[model samples]
Target: MEGMAITRTDMLSVADTVAREKSIDREHVLEAMEQAIQKAGRSKYGHEHDIRATIDRRTGEISLARYIEVVDEIENEVTQMTLGEALSEKPDAKVGDFIVDELPPIEFGRIAAQTAKQVIVQKVREAERERQYEEFKDRVGEIVNGVVKRVEFGNVTLDLGRAEAVLRRDEIIPREHFKRGDRVRAYIYDVRREQRGPQIFLSRTHPQFMAKLFAQEVPEIYDGVIEIKKVARDPGSRAKIGVISQDSSIDPVGACVGMRGSRVQAVVTELQGEKIDIIPWSPEDATFTVNALAPAEVSKIVMDEESGKMEVVVPDDQLSLAIGRRGQNVRLASILTGWDIDIMTEEEESQKRQAEFNERSERFMEALDVDDVIARLLVTEGFTSVEEVGYVPVDELASIEGFDESVAEELRARARTFLETEAERLDTRRKELGVEDALAGLAGLTPAMLVALGEAEVKSIDDFADLAADELTDKEDGILKSFPIGEQEASDLIMDARVAAGWFSQEELDAMRAEAAAAAEAEAAEAAAEAAAAEGAEEA
Candidate 1:
C-alpha cells in the first residue's frame, strides 16, 4: 500500500518523464495532470460542483478547490454567488472576485489512475504532433534523407528520424522504384498539419531537388559565388540548369560539372541516368536562350518581347539537335528561359522570306500601279507596306542602292495616293455602317476595324466598353470576326474605350481604394480597443 501511494514529487517526476519522452513542454504535462485531478475531484464530489485544480510549478504542490465567482446577483448556486455571500467568507471580497473553497486530496483507485494516464498520454501525443508541425513547417524546401518505412500503392513512406513524410507516387521520378528499407532522398515541398497528423509531402522529381543536389556537390554554388538562376527538368530523362557566376574568375558550369564530370555524374546516378545540360546564364535573353539549347548551334534569333516568344533559326543539320528527341531540348530551354520558342532551319526561313517578299511585291504593284520590276525593287528595299513608303522620309527611300531621288519621290507620291484612296473607301464604308467618330479615334483600330465594329453593332463607346477584351481580339472568334489583333492591343483599345465612356479614372479609383483602406484600419482599431477593454474587465 505504501508503494502504491503516489506522492506530489512523484507526480512532478512523472510529468518530467512524460515531457522528455514525448518531446513536449513540461508545463503542458503538468496542466494535463491538473485537469485529470479536477476531473477526479468532480467525480468524488457532486457532479454539478465547479471543481478546479492547480499544480505549483516550483514546489509541485497540488491544490483542489470549488470556485464561485462573486457577482451582483446569485445566478447558479454551484458556480456563482452574490457579493454579500462572498464578503461573508472574505471580509474584503468584491464583485467579480473568485471565492474558493479548498477540498481534501483525492486517493486514486484503479479506474481513476487509468483515466489520468489516458488523459496524460492523449495530451502528450497532441503536443508532440504540434511540435512536429512547428518544427517541419518552416523546413519546407530542404533536402531530407530517410529510410523507406513502407510502400503502399506506389507511394513511399519515409521515416525521417523524428518525423515521417510521404513521397507521393506522382512526385516520384517516373519508372523509379522504391521498396521498404531502401534509403531515399527527396525535397520537402510541402508540410500541412492535418486532422490526423502533420503531412510532410516530399518529391524527388521536383526541379528544386536537382538544384539542391547540385548545391550539395558544388561548393561554389553552396558558398554563393555561383548562383543557380533556373532549373527545368523532364524528370528521369533530361534537365537544364541555368547558372551564373558572380565572380568573373569562377566558371559556374565548370564548378557544377566537377572533375571529369564526377559531380554531375553523382547527381545523374541518383536521378536514374538523367542527362543534364549546364548552361551559362546571361541577362541577355537571346544569349541565354542560345546557351540553353546547347550542342545545337543557333544562326539567328528573332525575339518578340511583347509576345514572350523567340524564333530560333538554326542550320538544317542542327535542326534535329535543337528540337531534340520529342522536342525535349527546346521544351526545357523554353521553361528555363520563360519564352515560347519556335525552331526553324535556315532553308525554311529563306522560303518564308521569299514568300513574304512576293506578297509585298504584288501589293505594291497593285496599289501603286507600278511595273513588276519596280515593285520588286521596292520590296527588295525592305518596304513591306505602303504606309511605310508614305511615312518614311524621301531621303531614306532614296538611300536604297538602286533608287534615285526622282524614283523615291514618285514612289512616295504613289504611296500617299493609294493610302488616301484606301482611307476614303474605308471611311465611306464606316459612315455607311454608322461607326462612332470616338471609336474611330482610338489607336490600333484601323478604319476597317471600325467598320467591322459598326457592322457588329459596337458603334458607341459604351458598347465597346461593354465588350470583353477577348471578344474584341481573340483570333478564332472575335467581334472583329476575321481580323486578328494582339492581346495587348486589345487591352489598350478596351481601356481607351472605357475611358472614353466616362468610367472612373485611374486617380479616382486610387482615391477610392485609399478611402476604403482608411475605413478598414479604423474598424480594426475599434475592434482591438474593444478586445483590450473586455480583457481588462475579465481581469478585474
Candidate 2:
C-alpha cells in the first residue's frame, strides 16, 4: 500500500507542455497518460485481468488497481471469485461487488515504455484531430489565408496554421501556380470527415470565391448596402456578377467598380486578371440577360416562361461577340440568369417565324377546308391549331379584320367538324392498337396518348401504373412525348392509374398529395424569395 501510488511533478509538466503545444485541454492529456499507464500495468500483470488506472489532476499522483468480481460462481480464476472466497478478505463483501487489489508501482522496462509511448502518441493524435475538426467545420464558405505546404501534380495542399486544406487541381484557376512557402488565399468550400481524417476542401476558382473576394474588397457589399445577386466565373478568363442595390442613391455596379476602379482592380489581380462585367441585376430576365451579355448589342428577345428557355437575336456581325470565345459569354450569362439560351441572328429568327406561320396556315387551310388566303388571315390572327379555332368565341373570331359573323361561324363549324373526325380516327387507331378500356378511363391520357401507350405495350391499368413519369413523358421517346403535358401532370396521371389498379387507396393518395402540396408550397415560396433577389435572361 505504501508504494501503490506514485507522484511525479514531471508528469504534470509534460501534460502542460503537450497540451499547450497541441492546443488541447490539459485534462485530456492527463487522461491519455492515464490510459498509457493502465496499458503498462496490464502488460506487467496478466493481460486478462481487469486493470484500471487514474491520475489525480492536482498532484499528478498515479494509481493502478486490479478488479475481480465477487460472484456466486467463478467465471475465470484471474478476475472472478465465489462469495466464500471473498468473505475471507472482507466481511461485508456481497455478490455483484468488485474486490479491487491495489497494484504496486510498476518499473518501466524498455518494451513496456515503448508500448506506453505508442498508446500516448496515438491518443494525443486522435485528440488533436477532434480539436481541428471542431474548430474548422463551421469555417466552411469563408475565405482562409494559408501557406502552400506542398504541390503534387498541380494539386495544392495548403497549411492553414491549425488545419490542412486540399485545393484540387480542378479547383485551381487556369494560369495559377503555387510553390512551397508561398502565401495563398482560398475559399473553404467543404469540410468532410473522411476515413483518413477531416478533409477541408478549398477552391480558388469557385464562383462564390470571387463574390467573397469582392465582399472583402468592397465595403458596400460587406455591409449589405449593395447585394450581389449572382456570380458566374469562367476562371482566369472572365466572369459576370449581377448586383442589386437596396438604396436608390447607390448604384450597385458603380459601388462594386469602386472609385477609380480600385476595388475591382484589387479583385481582378487576385483572380489572375480575369475580366469581370459588373452588370446591373434586373428582375426582368430579358433585361438582366441583355446586361449580362455586355460589349454586344441585342436586337430582340423571345422568352418561354414555362420552359425557362430564351432565344436572343443579335445582329449578324455582333453574334461572335455575344457568344464570346467558345461560347463562354453566353454560357456565363445562362448560369448567371438561370436560363437555357439559344442565340440566333435576326435573319434566322425571321425565317423561323415565317416557317411557323406557314405551318399554321397550312394546318388551318386543311382543317377548315378554306383557301390559302382565308387560312393566312386566320393564321395572322394567331390561330395555330384546329382546336383553337373550334374553341375560340365566335364573336371574337368575327371581330377579326374582314371577317363577318357568318364567315366566322362557318369557319368555326368546319374546325369543330375536323376535330370530331380526328378524334374518331384517333379512337379507332387506339382500339386497333389493343389499348384497354380501363386505360382509356384514366384522366390526362388522350386518345392519341393511349395509342402511343398501346404501341409501347402499356395497355392495361396495371402496365401503366408500373411506369415512371419519365417513361410516360420523356422528351426523347416517352409515350406522350409529343404532348405538352409536363412531368408533374404525367406523374399525377400515373398515380391515378395506380389508384385504379388498387396499388394504393384513394385516401392514402389524397394524404400523400396533401403532404406533397404543402412541401411544394414551401419550396415555391423559398424559390420566389430567392428569385426576387436575383435575375434571369435570354429571349429573341
Candidate 3:
C-alpha cells in the first residue's frame, strides 16, 4: 500500500483476488483497500482496525477472528453472544468465535457507532469504483445515449446509465448546445481508469459520426449496395461525401440523397443544418473532377494527368458561378477531389483567334486604299490580305450580315483588276511616298484601336504626322490612357504622320486645318438659321 501496510490476512487475500480478476497489479488493489479501511477505521474505531492481518505467501490462506462477550442475556448485542446460543453454534461448548466466551472491558457507545459508520462508507466507495471500472472499460468507440448533467469549462458531463462521461470542447461541434437533462448521443472516444474514478471521453465531432448516421438511416449504405468511398468535412459548416454503387442500376448519389433529399437532410439536421454535397465517386479522374464541381455546368474538361490537374471550361456566363464567392467552391472541390481545377471562358478563346488575323491585314489594306471593314471581312474569308481577295470564300463572306453572295463574288473579282489598274495610276505616287511594300508586324494592339484612329482621319503614317501634339491629344479624352503604348513609343509614332499637303511638319498643318474647318462650319450654320428666321418674319 502507498500510505499504509495491510496487516489483516483476510483483507490482503481479498485484495489479491480482486487485482487478479481486474487485471490490475496487486499493489494497486492493496492501496485502494488500505484507503477504504483507513477511512472506516478512523471514523468508527477512533484510531484504526487493531486486528493485525498478514498474508501466508505459500498457503494463500486467510484467517480471521474477532472477540465478543459470553453473557447469559445480551445487553450490548454487537459485543456479546448469549452462552446458550454460542454453544449451539459450535456444538463443542464454545461461547465465542474468537478464543474465550468472555466480554471485553472496553466501552461500547459512540466509538463503536463511529467504527460501524466508517466501515460501511469505505466498503460502499470501493464497490462503486470497481463497478465503474467494469462498466466503462469496454465502451470505447461505441455510441451511447446520455443526458447532460452539467457543463464545466466547456466540458459537458453526460449521465450514462451506469457512469458519467465527459465530452470535451475540442471534441464538440460548433454551434451545438445541450440544455440541462437534454438527451445527447455521442461516441465513446476513450476510457481512463484513474485513482478517483473511471473517466470516459465522448465525441460528437468525429468523421465516423457522420458515417454512422448514414449507416443508420440509408438502407443501401448499410446493405452495401452503396459504399461511402470517401468523406471530407468542414464540420457544422459543410461536408462532401463521395459514394459509389455496387449494383449498376442503383444510383449512389440518389441512394444517399434519398427521395427529395430526405436522408441527407436528416443527417444535415443532426449536424445543426450543415450542408452536404453527395458526389458520385468515380475511378476516372476527369469524370470525378466534373462531378466534384457540382451545381455548375462544364463545357469541357481538359486534364494534365501527370500533375493530377484538370481545367474546366464553362460558358462565359457561368464563369462566376463555377468558381463561387472568393473561390470557395473551387477550393472545397480541390480538397474533396484531390485535384487542382481551373475555369476558362468562351469569349476569351474567340477574341484571341480574331486578333491574330487582323495583324496580318494592315499592310494589304494600306496598299489597296481599302477601308478596314472590307479588309477584315476579306481576312475572315481567308484571303491572306486585301491584295489576295480574288479567291475569297464568297459563301463565307455572304454569311456576314448585309452582303449578298453575288456582291461578295463581284468584290473578289474586282479586287485583282482594281489593284493592277491602281498600280499603274499610283506608280509615281507610290514611289515618291515609298509605299510600295505594306507595313507588317503591327500586333500588340487591338483592331478596335486601329479602326477608331481611322474614323478620326488619322489613317497612314503621313496622316498621323499632320497632327500637332495638342491636336492629337484633343482627338480623344484621356487618349494616352486609352492607348496601350508607353511615352517613348507614342513620341516615335507621331513622327511618321503626314497630311495631303506633303508638309513634313504635319502636326502644325493638321491643327490649323482642324481649327479653320470648325470656324467655317459654325459661321455657315448660323447664317442659314438667320436666313430661315427672316423668311418666317416676312411671312408673319
Q: List the global CA lDDT of all models.
A: 0.89, 0.90, 0.65
Q: 324 in model 2: Cα distance from truth in Å?
A: 2.0
Model 1 spans > 4 angstroms off: 1-6, 42-50, 73-77, 109-115, 363-540
Candidate achieving the largest TM-score: 2
Query: Of the pair 1 and 3, which is ahead by lDDT?
Result: 1
10 residues in a row with least lDDT, candidate 3: 436-445
Per residue, candidate 1 scores C-alpha lDDT tens digits across 58-106 of 8888889999899997778889989888888999999989989998877
List model 2 lDDT by residue over 301-396, tens digit each.
999876677999999999999999999999999999999888999999999999999999889888888899999998888787899999899999
Residue-wise C-alpha lDDT for candidate 3, range 1-540, written one tens digit per residue: 233323446556776676666555575555554444344433444432233222345453332224455677667665577777677656665543432332122222454445534553455556667777787888675778999999888889999876888999888889787778999988887888887788888888876677778877899887767888777666788777788988899988888889899998999988888788889989887787778778778888777664455778879888887787678667767777887787777676456546767675675566545678766765765666545565556786577666788867767667776667665555444334443121111333234444445545454555555555554333245243354454435544454333333555667766776888899999999999986885566456
| Structure candidate 2, residue pairs in collision | 285-536, 301-539, 301-540, 302-539, 302-540, 311-539, 311-540
Ranking by lDDT: 2, 1, 3
The regions of model 2 sitting more than 4 angstroms off are: 1-7, 69-97, 393-395, 398-413, 420-442, 447-482, 487-540
